[model samples]
Target chain A: MDIVIVVADAVRASVGPLGAAYALTAIGLNLHYGYTGLLNFGHVAFLMVGAYGTAVTVDQGGPFWLGILVGVIAAILLGLLFGLPTLRLRVDYLAIVTIAGGEVLRTVIRSGDKDSLTGGVFGITQFATTFFGANPFPEGEYGWGRLAFTERQLWVAVVAWSLVALATILLVLLVRSPWGRVLRSIREDEDAARSLGKNVFAYKLQSLVTGGVIAAFAGMIIAIERQSVHPDTYLPAGTFLAYAVLILGGTASRLGPVLGAVVYWFLFEFTDGFLRGAISAGWIPGASSRRPTSARSE
Target chain B: MPADAVFAAEAVTGSRKPDAILVVNGMHRSFGGLAAVDVGHLEVQRGVITALIGPNGAGKTTLFNLLTGFDRPDGGSSTFDGRPVTGLPPHRIARAGMIRTFQLTKALAKMSVLDNMMLAAPHQRGERIVYAPLRSAWRHQERDVEERAGSLLEKFGLADLRDDYAATLSGGQRKLLEMARVLMAEPKMVLLDEPMAGVNPALVESLLHHVRELRDEGLTVLFVEHDMDVVMGISDWVVCMGEGRVISEGRRRSWPPTKR
Candidate 1:
């Protein structure tokens, strides 16, 4: 196997739409954790909500764009549903509710009773054909052999990266403005910001809703990339990865989250490839790639 | 105190006339079983620096919170500009031209010093989310705000540290920054809760000077301070509170002069 091809594949996935999805998700996390000092551990729940919202709506005969719109609205509603009562309490309570909320959402979508709508354990597909058909890229292979994706993947990647860029610009402009400053001040101390005439509770709710909606877009982008939605797709591990991206890209830094995602995915995928390569070469005796010791191979 | 009582008796029903900008009647607040504030009647005359002197737990801060809408009173009526302002939110009270500073100096630590000052500018169009993206709408107003903030910073001798994070400032500097920031609202009345709590001696003198300048500029100032010299030096009148009640209310000189 050509090691360069493996590395190239890692790089492509790192900077492509796959990476940008995490970047967008991390942007919302940055706003929640970085700027507002909120502890929303169930951030991936919005992405789950977004994915199912789009997939189910499309399955029900709605247009792909409408599905995406529904996904966004769903995320916004979820934010409010969690925020309206929780935001008034201490920050840690939001953390507890959000983490538990993520688990609840994942488990509910996997319920056997909802299999007809959610596709249950098998998940949903055929919902992203409309999304890929509008890719605008001419049919051809891009990148090295085995490392390559169709022009369709290239189109999705382009849109994802662009969306990340747009969101970054929007966030930078917001934080520098007076309204953004109020959010930061709220993070510093709510009572202090309140005494300065800011509506502290209102601002907190807005940040939560804004961040959650952005996380929804992350879900949409990810679903479009995979051409499918699985209940496991929005796992708690993904949130942990997004947080790793958030931490890697220092808190409160405007471009940190996206950069963190890019670097993180590159190293992460590269390490997995390296470990597999090493195992196949007999460098590690006990490592298994799940082939179960073939009878002909002795 | 006796003269004030006689004057108060002659003016109206158990209280003086309403010439003051801030007038409170029967304002009371309690925390659990403890009565925190129970001011029967009080007036802060406009265009003067009135010092509210009280020991710890004497209800000065509680009164300030109630008047500024940071806290609600269980029973009372108070007015600013002849408008009832007993139960409005803090922001509404701030918009109505009564700005305040915290006792511990609530400087936004992570923000630049200039940002802390600029954030307090009243009626900022950029603060509205819908109009924030439209740069042209608030650009000129932002410039004006920055200019005002710059001038205030300069007046407080913090012009050089405008770009530095507020967290880097000394305790005394933070106090000055808070004072300068409150001016951004152009409030008609300013309530200062221990404005010089941790300030150095030299800065205290300067702080008193700024307080005088505030009165000179015709803004009503009601400050809660334990510093007797600073109070007597700058305040036109002194109101003394002890155990949630006004023990004495009089001019700076007549209270047995120089207990120090």
Candidate 2:
């Protein structure tokens, strides 16, 4: 293969990892939007918090599991902080608050003042050892030919996909249960659920916390795979990507997010790959530099 | 199983002082310059069907909303089963064993009929935690809940539609489903806002029968209705509201100049 083709092939292999993480994050958005009718535009903030929580903890000498736990807790706390004031408000208010929150969180994490602890513009690194240390697979190339993965990549894929599967199953079971029904009922009509003795606010809070934690888990996986945590990774576009995934997949359907994530990543990769190939072939000149802008627009 | 025996027993227990399942004293609610409700005393008796009837904008639903915590009263004390319930949130008041149905029939449109019933049941203590695995014991509890819900749906002749989404049901069926859902909570009293409104004549008969059945089954029923036939046909006692206050109250036979 040509060098460009070889590089594209390498990137294609990484889509699985990226897709797995997105699937998890999308599932969280699915819970908030599809099931509960919550307009949470700050979902990316949960991802950022998760990634930073894990990176910061691991960088500070915490165990990988501890970092994961801290990430989950931070996500939950962030969810509460965001949900408490806004979830009680109308949908429009929540949407505004959440979108603004995502931006604010990104700015704070990237702030020049917090450079020492957060590594400022340089971002955090050397934090993947904790996660990679737990990998049980022996180091070697895995997968068939063009779709091959190194042992490290395969391990990350396994762990990330496993988390997605577990989250999906748990969500399925929960939505089917009495508790899940309450969430759906609240989504259908909050006053009705309240009349039936369901604390609407509490259920909304729980849904936010659960979904946020899931998003955080996805963020942690992404941070681990990249071996870094940067504020730019948690852009508003990430939230929109999650929303797109949620919509593409039937909302309130258990496998919807995962299916959406897969389709989204596949289409995204195909488009990028085709575009890059066209640029290299001179079919689309100056497309390489513009690709990042188009990708960001998406 | 004989309805007469229960009725006779209730009668022989002379003067059968109406057990106040809920007591609203000095309740007041105002909207801007208009006083919506200003009742001095209103007692919802246990185990009897009571009707709160009034013309449009008479504040019948508003009172229900206030007493049930669906809306806050400007001022008043509400006592439910000897517990001071003033100003409690709707869910808390509901969990205290008093559930209500909406005038518009707020059924869970997206959920299956059975799931709607199950959701009405209070959440178990252990279900709140994330790490708590589904144990066999909880499964058994869930099965019992499902069985109970199924039986209630069957009682209301809705068993065949158990798996169907509630939104797919007709207006009458939605009303029936709302009633059935409330039963899942085993609430002491159910405040139904216009259960007979918008129901077909055939379904109205069934709805009235079920309301009577609910009373016979020892659940207090308070409903708001404009249908005089329904109000007189089923209500043990009728309270009429006009301009936001109880204008008149009497036995069904004695309510007169009854032309709204």
Candidate 3:
């Protein structure tokens, strides 16, 4: 039997793109939850639209840039559609509607009827040519010792992390401005801000659109990195993870989300690695350590 | 001499146009079975200090709310500067040049005193996103706002508290700050509800000076005050309300003045 020790560092390196994707999504969550105080549980719906928009565009022979544009437009449109009716409703209603809306989008895309376009349970594959073609890096593997990545993976990491940094800077500058003060004021007390001549609903809509666009950009990057698309990639679990990252980082602070993203991914990697090692070493009583266990285990 | 003669002469000579700066006609409001206000035909003339006085539960506050667009009336209409203003939102009504202060001094507590004034300024081009970042254009406007706020604060002896949070101010200072914030908007008329309700005597004198100064500066002033001495000393015209309707209307000195 071959013994392959995939420690925390190794696991992190292997799943580097996934962590980056989550980090980007979490940044968007920070904008919604932290700054604006919106409880958006359907953020994953925007992610799904970005992923499917990009995938379907590429599958239909559209250029990668065009796919990215369509994904962004889809995200903005979805944000407006979600925000128009719900933002004016009470906060609790918005939360319920958003969570339900996300679940509906996920189930619809994964349904059997949409299999031809969305690839149903099988998912879509071979959708990365346009993305890889635009890679600025030379075609080769990159990184050191335990953190090696193929040329394509390196490109994805560069794009994903760069987008995260740029978005964070933009958000910091924006939230620091007078406009941002009105937003924070609205978060504190909507009626007070309204009395100050601020259009509260308009500010809420702007926040939703901006945050959704950032999340969709992250989703596009994720689809490009995986070279495929799957409906399961955008689940309630993903939204929950982003929210965890946001809270851990600190809500409404500019660099909190980025810091949160790094800490969350590292912690997740460490816990998963330690659990796997403990289970294999027969330190926990879950599956039998003997060979030829159930086929479901495999 | 009849106080009505003085009021009539002042009304005609000041600006006799039938359209008062603010006119409340047959205004009535009810909260369930309770009638909070039932004012009929109140006119606030331009460039004069008119005081609305009544005992507690006389609907003075409700009348202020209806005039300022904070609450809707169950019946009748309000017109400001000849335009119907009955249904406009409070902010819109404020932007239309009629500003008001609350009895409780509704300052934005979390914001700095200076910020409260800036937010109160009318026609803020910088509120829009495209124009918010324009430093060059807004710098002049921002400076003017700051200067006006600073002058008003200085005039009210609050110059040193510019950077302080409004919530940190004393109750009297909050009342003064609320008055200063309304002045920042350059309103054509001001509706001050209980401007001196809880203010200290020293600040009350300052507030009276400012109210007189507002009239001197050609801004119409209508304030609800229970202090008969203060109302009679500064008010050119007085309208007394009781049980949600006007009981008497006359000049301040001749209306069987009530002692505080």
Candidate 4:
């Protein structure tokens, strides 16, 4: 196994478009959990809506920008749908509703009934022509061998990371202001904030909408990067992974999610690269790269 | 000690209603067939430290909850500063210049002592989600709020602990912080639910002084207490409740009537 190749792959995964998307999603989660004390267990629902909204709009003869707008609006409405009834009750209620909501949305999108609109279990593809057509990267390989990105990947990477930087800047400013002060106080104790003349419910709903919108943007980035919107991709596992990234980076701090996403993807790709290399060299007994695929297809 | 005698005595003291900061009439509340509070009539005068005293389950806390809009009354009306405030949400009531502290002392434990104080300042423009990301919009007002919070912290002897989380404060310090945080809102009336229930003996003197200073500064105070000495020391008037009714009320000098 070439140690250099494993490190290169790990570095590529950490700074790539996927890491950017994960960072964006976890940033939203930080706003929800770290700042507002909300338990949004099904954050992937926002990503799913974002991805599907853009894809369906584009598929139905809309402009790319319109698709992005539609995705954002869908996520806002979803946030309201999940937040309106539960935010006033208890924090745990939001958790249960969000988790259930994510699964339900995925199942509905992939079900046979929505096949005409959503492409059912197979999902949507080849919808990124507008996004890539506007890519400013030249038609060439962009870096060193195996550590390089094609022009298309570079375009997506630039856009995704820019979005991450913008989101982080916004959160940093917002959390340092008086508004952020109220949020932390609410996160500490709702009744205390209420007694001090703060509208607890309205603030909670606003936090939910803000985080949900950011997650939706993350979904758009993912769909744009992959040139597809797969229903199965927006699973409960995606939300759990975002949470892992959020916690790993440390909550309530700006840029923590970005760092966490990078570290998490580095380890993930490093292990995968190491294992694949080991298997190819026949270094591990009874272990084959082909074995995992066969089991997954079953 | 009959119900009529209680009512007769209440009516006599209730004559000073014209300048009362808070007035309640026939306020009632119950939980699962158990009447928690059923005050027939109560009035707290403006700019005086009044105490509500009772035994366990006597509904002192329930009355405070109802008055501050934490809990709704089954049937009744209340007016604060001559405005109808009945059935308003707690936040609205708080904005209307009535602030309250909890018996358990909700100090926003995870937040810094300074952040807790700054959070209570009313009319913060940056608290609005739209204005939050813009530093220039609320910056001036924020500085002003911080100055006010700083002064309050200094007054409460929490200036050094301003950056420390409320969780780091002792029980007595938390009680002090809660009181100071309440003042940050510039409340016209303050409701304290057992402000000294768990406070240390040394800190109790400071707490009493602060309550006295609040009244002297022209803010009306309504507090619940079980300690007669503390009550007698600070309260200008006292209302005694028993089994969900105000059993007796009297001027401070005449309270705790002596047996012949």
Which candidate achieves the best lDDT against the true structure? 4
Real contacts recovered, all predictions: 0.70, 0.64, 0.23, 0.94
Instruction: Write down the TM-score of every candidate.
Output: 0.91, 0.90, 0.82, 0.95
lDDT of all predictions? 0.85, 0.81, 0.76, 0.89
TM-score of chain A of each: 0.93, 0.91, 0.90, 0.96
Candidate 3 lDDT tens digits, A1-298: 1123345363554357766677778878887877677889899888889988888888878887788888999999989988999997768877888889888888877885544778787777778796778888898767665567778888888878888888887777666556666666666556555555566788888888888999998788777777778887887877888888888888887777777777777776565555556677887887655443321121
lDDT of 1 at B87: 97
Question: Looking at model 3 chain B, which ten-residue stretch has the lowest summed lDDT?
Answer: B9-18
User: Where does model 2 sit among the CAPRI classes?
Assistant: medium
What is candidate 1's DockQ? 0.65
TM-score of the second chain for every model: 0.92, 0.89, 0.89, 0.93
Considering summed lDDT, which 10 consecutive residues are worst modelled in model 4 chain B? B1-10
Clashing pairs in 1: none
Better of 1 and 3 by DockQ: 1
DockQ of 4: 0.84
Q: What total of clashing residue pairs does each candidate reach?
A: 0, 0, 0, 0
Ranking by DockQ: 4, 1, 2, 3
Docking quality (DockQ) for each candidate: 0.65, 0.51, 0.31, 0.84
Docking quality class, candidate 4: high
lDDT of 4 by residue, B1-260 (tens): 11112222333434454367899999999999999998888888787778999899999999888988889999999999889999998999999999999999999888889999999999999999899999999999999999999999999999999999899999999999999999999999999999999888999999999999998798989999998889999987788888898877776776664321
Per-residue lDDT of A176-277 in model 4, one digit per residue for the tens?
988898889889999999999999999999999999999999999989888888888887988999999999999998889999999999988888878888
